[model samples]
Target: MTLSLYNTMTRTTSEFKPLVEGKVGIYLCGATVQGAPHIGHIRSGVNFDILRRWLTHLGYDVTFIRNVTDIDDKILHKAVHENIPWWEVAMKYEKAFAWAYETLNVQSPTYEPRATGHITQMVELMQTLIDNGSAYAPGNGDVYLDVRALKSYLTLSNQKLDDLQSTGDSEDSFKKDPRDFALWKAAKPGDPSWPTPWGAGRPGWHLECSAMAHAYLGAEFDIHGGGLDLIFPHHENEIAQSESAGWGFAKVWMHNAWVTTSGEKMSKSLGNSLLVSEIVKKVRPIELRWYLGSAHYRSMVEFSFEALEENSINFRRIEGFLIRASEILQRTPDISISEKFAAAMNDDLAVPTALADISDLVREGNSAITAGDNQSLGTIAAQVRGALYILGCDPFDSVFASGAGSNSSAMDGLVSLALAQREAARARKDFAAADAIRDQILELGIIIEDTPAGPRWTLAR
Candidate 1:
């Protein structure tokens, strides 16, 4: 099946035809660098990473761009609260976000541009808008995008210009129209400033992404992605300004659903305790990635410790089967993606259905193991690993070899010792003792199964 993605612009899932065939460019709005990353922030990263991986698997040359907002209002406020330079605050949290992404095994983008580094490009973009009369400076050094001058506006958000509210990005006194959004803010008394034709000021949040995306991906790109919360003012303003400047902007807009808690969008305030660093201590990074990427990209993930634990256990079951299969085959199984799995991934990135395919393979592979069918086990294990590789959670991948909860070799040895005790009880005709030993292992969430070869232990689902 050909790839079909849900385009937020068209409000339909249609076949994806890249502007340039076999070459795809994607711009994903990255971290704002105001604080450490939580599961909610990383969900966008993982979702887009899956899309990039699938595109690569299909032989598309993918150039992925994820930009960092290094200088923002929140970063400045954090700097003031921490009694440091705003740049220092941005660098600190930016490093924290980088570490979190690496820990989760998210692949590095082709280019990760910082908003502050591309001030020249932003100034140039603003100048184009100004020359086209799509923006104006109101003598206060603040440049505002003239929403009324745009030939097309609010197409992505599907909102009427008359119904739009004030952008609230700058002082209403500085804008000729209340609906006009700021392209550049006038320099403050003691804030970072860049020299532009209009004045010495910094770019707005929406302007940074538009400039960075245009700078790296040229006038237009294949896909633009971010969280659902960005669909309104952020993305809408981007379209209004970029198109007014004679650029096509993004061809397809993909917005992932939020990771919610108690039916509220997960924010740093509500997700402070759920930081990636804190969550990794409870579950392995690979397991966390599995849990985060399990749902469809457009589906909301309800945040809860109980749900996380259940998903981690399910991942371990797959991991255990792969480990046992490797031992039986005496070598790592080669990756072999199944047709059903590929089809599921192709259909709008339906990760849940793709995962179900992997689960089915694992189940059949376990049954093959119990029946001593090495050939079938090898084929099924290969397919399972292939499917997992696309999801960025392949057990054999070196990225997950030595992180938290990766002591699988030691776990196997300990389970083997317990199985030894159970075998001894059964050998001595002590059925009661054997049953008790099995019960103890089950309490630890490990299911011990006696087969023709020996006792196999897997994490209970």
Candidate 2:
């Protein structure tokens, strides 16, 4: 089936046709590098990673760009609060976000451009906007986009220019219209400054993305993506500035829904944010990724420890099934993704549907285990691994292999010692002692099942 995606610009789901027949270019708005990442921030990364993987799986040569805003006002503010250089502050959290992405198994983008490194591109684009009469310098070394002058100003956001509020990135007095936003902010005292034709200053938040996208993906690209929160002023401004400069910036726009807590958007100000590092301690990284990507990309995920633990336990069941199947087969099985899973993925990355298909495979695999049907079990195991591989949750995949099973060598030894004691008590006809030991292991969330091969242990559901 041909891939289809929901375009935020058109507000519809349609077939995806890349500008180049077999090549796809995607530009994703990446982190601002002001603070450590929370699950809210990483959700976008995981959702897009699935998109990239599916596209690649379909034989498309995908060039993905995820940019970093290293010179943002937030970064400078954080530097002040931490008593460090602004660049140091940016680097610190940039590393933190990188670690978080890696831990969650998010594939690295083909190119990750930093705002500071692309000053020349931003300057050139601003000059193009000025020459095209779509921007003004205002004699203060600051450049502002002429919001009222553009014939297609708010089309992406589906808003009327007259009804809009002030852009807020610059002083209203600096703009021809209060609604106009900053293309360049004039340098202030003790702030980082880069030389530009309009004197010394830094690029605005919106300009960094347009400049980098054009520099890397040319005048037009396949898809531009970010959180739904960016649908407003940020992405809208990108369209205004880039189109005014005579470039078809992005053919399609995609925005993933927010991760919310108590029906409120997750943010530091809300005091309900869960950092990736801390959350990983409570559950495995792969389980966290699965939970984050479980919902459709366009749906909100309500954050709750209860829900997260439930999903993680469900994932362990699937992982446990795959492990048992592997042991029965006595060798690694070949991967073969089912058509139903692919069709669901093709339909606008319908992850929940694809996951449901995975659950069905698990159920069938379990039944095969019950019937001792090794031939059928092997095929089902391969299909399960293939689906999990697409979702980045394959238990045996190198990224998650280290933490694949609960029964590691140390854990196995301890459980086995306890089981040995129970066996000894049973041999001596001490039924009470055997039952007590069994109860203790059960309290540790381990279940021991006796088979003709001997007693076997597994983590309790």
Candidate 3:
């Protein structure tokens, strides 16, 4: 089957035909970089990362651009509140985003653009709009896009021009219509401002993306993506600005649903919004990725601590199968993975279904091992690894690749200390001391089975 994607632009699923024959261009809207990224951010990144991997698997060179909005109101507010510089705030959160992405196994974007660094390109685009009579600047140095000028201003949003609600201070008097959003905001005292044609000012929230996307990806791109929450005002305004600027804008618009807590929207008001760091401390990282990736891309993901604990448990079963399979490989290894899972992945990147098939293969591999069929077991294990790797859920990967896992160095040191105590007791003919060491190891949430084969260890169940 040809790769088919549900395009929000067309409101339908269609076979994906790239602009270039063997290449894909994807632009995903990244975060504002004001805070540590939560699961809401992870949902979009993981959902699209799987898609990018699938496209690459099918022999498409994907140039994915996920931009960072570093110069937004939130970043400014955070800088003033924390008594830190605005750039410092952006850098701190950007680092946090990178840390979260690595732990969650979300594949990095091909080009990660920061909005602040692209001011020249933004100014040039605003100049183009001004020359084209689609935008104007007031006496106060504030620039606004004239909504009445564009023929297709509201086409992407599907909202009537007049029937729109917006919040701004100079909105009512400056705008010919309330729906006409800002292209640029004039500089305020002590605010981070760039020198522009409209005096010293900063680009608006919506205009920054338009400028960045056009500057890097040209007037048009193959795929544009982000959270469903950005569908209104943000992305819609991007389309208007680009399309009105005489560029084709984006061909396809893809959005991933939010991660909610307890069937309610995760918000500061609800006091239930959990950070990625807090959640990762409680659960394994890859298991958290699995929970976010279980549902279809457009479906809302309900998250909770209890759900994550179950996901972590389920992941262990897969990991245990991999550990056993690895031993089978060590003995006699001539295994080739099946491409049937690839076929499923090509069907719009159906990860959950592919994962289910991998589980079935694990079951088959286990039964075959029981029947002394090592060859079949190794082959199935190879295929399972291939599928899981594409899904970013490789079970063989160390759970604590980063410091995010429950397996801390402190805990490991304690385990080794207990083991050393046991050895010391054995040397001194102190069986009681050795037994006490063994008990101490158990108390630290580790199982130590002293087999005749040698000492063996695993995390406690």
Candidate 4:
């Protein structure tokens, strides 16, 4: 089936056609990395990761580029607070982000360029704009894009020109127009500085993606995505600068909605934002990822302990099936993945529906287990795994090795030890000890539930 995506630029769901016949180039806006990432950070990554995985599965040579805005006002502020250099701050969090992404199983992009690393590309792009009259250096040694010179400046957003704030004009001391945003900022005291024909300064927030995307993915690309919060001013300015400067920019634009907390927006002020590391300690990393990948990409998802709790429960249900099937089916049969699952995913990455499909397969697999039909269960399990590759859900893993409850245990030993402890805890009327052992089991990404047949545990893939 041909994939279809909802283009934010055209505001329509159209069948995806790669600019190059068999290759797809995608540039997704990555986290600024000024602080530890939150659950909200993974939604866009998870959605686009699925897009890349599905396209690759369908025989497309996908080149994915996710840029890191390592040089930003926030990074500078953080550096000053810690009494460290700005580069140190950026590097610290960049490593943290990579660890979190690995934990969530989001695929690494083909090119993950840092804004500071691509200064030359940014300078060249800005020079092209100035030479073409779409941008200018207005005597302050800083560069700004001229909004008035570009006919399609605000076309992507369709926001009225009068509605934009004339407020951000520190560069060139008030660019040609109030809405004309900065392309480069002249260096100030105690901030990171770089050499450029525009003088000693740094790249602006919007300039990095335009430069990096052009540098890595060519003039035009297949898909561009980020959080919905960036559609305005950020991506809109990208469209203005790239199109005005003659790079074709992107054909399809996609944005995932924000994650709300307790019926309010998740923000620093509320002090309710759950960092990825903190939540990883509470539940399995896969559970945290499942919550992010559980909903429709375009829908505004709420974040709460209750929601995560519910997600944790649902993830355990699916983990239960994968575990039981692994034990009951010693000789698995060759399986063909279902096309209906593919169709659901191809439709704008309709993940909620895809998740429902996975649930359906789990129910069928469970029934097969009851009837001792290993062949049917193995076939369905294979299909479920193919679907989960798109979801970044690791349903069953053979090497839940390192982060398991303990370090020094053979596969047979870990399973046997856990079961023996469970029986011992149950006989001693030691419910607290029993619960502690259960948590120990979960830390290994293995879930145990007491059943009428007997106490059973499943490895969370």
Candidate No. with top TM-score: 2
Model 2 poorest ten-residue lDDT run: 398-407
Clashing pairs in 1: none
- lDDT, residue 176, candidate 2: 84
> Residue by residue across 1-461, what tens digits does model 1's lDDT show?
79999999999999999999899999999999998898999999999999999999999999999999999888988888999999999999999999999989899999999999999999989888888788998878899998888788889889898886655665487777888888999999888899887889898999999999999999988999999989998999888888888899999999999888888887766543479999999888998999999999899999898999999989988988888898789888889889999999999999899988999999999999889899999999999989889999888888887632345898989989989999999999999999999999999998888867778776764
The sequence of per-residue lDDT tens digits that candidate 3 reaches over residues 209-303 is 99888877888889999988788878888987887789988898888888887787776556676888988877778878878876678888788
Q: TM-score of each candidate?
A: 0.91, 0.94, 0.87, 0.88
Q: Model 1 segments beyond 4 Å from truth?
A: 166-170, 269-273, 403-450, 455-461
lDDT tens digits, residue span 1-461, model 2: 79999998898999999999999999999999998999999999999998998899899999999999999888888888889999999999999999999999999999999999999999999999999899999989899999888888777788887787645665468788888889999999989999888889999999999999998999999999999999888999999889999998899999999999999999988888899999999898999998998889899999999999999988988888888887778877678889989999999999899888989999999999889999999989998988888887777877775654535899899989998998899899998999998888899888887764567788764
Clashes of each: 0, 0, 0, 4
* Candidate 4 lDDT score relative to the true structure: 0.81
Please give the range of 10 consecutive residues that has the lowest summed lDDT in model 1.
398-407
Please give the range of 10 consecutive residues that has the lowest summed lDDT in model 3: 397-406
- What tens-digit string does per-residue lDDT give for candidate 4 at 270-324? 7877788999888888788888888888988888878888998998777656656
Q: 2 or 3: which has the higher lDDT?
A: 2
Total backbone clashes of candidate 2, pairs 3 or more residues apart or in separate chains = 0
Candidate 4, residue 315: how far the Cα is off, in Å: 1.2
What is the Cα-based lDDT of residue 306 in candidate 2? Answer: 95
Q: Give the runs in model 4 whose Cα sits over 4 Å from its true position.
A: 165-172, 331-336, 398-461
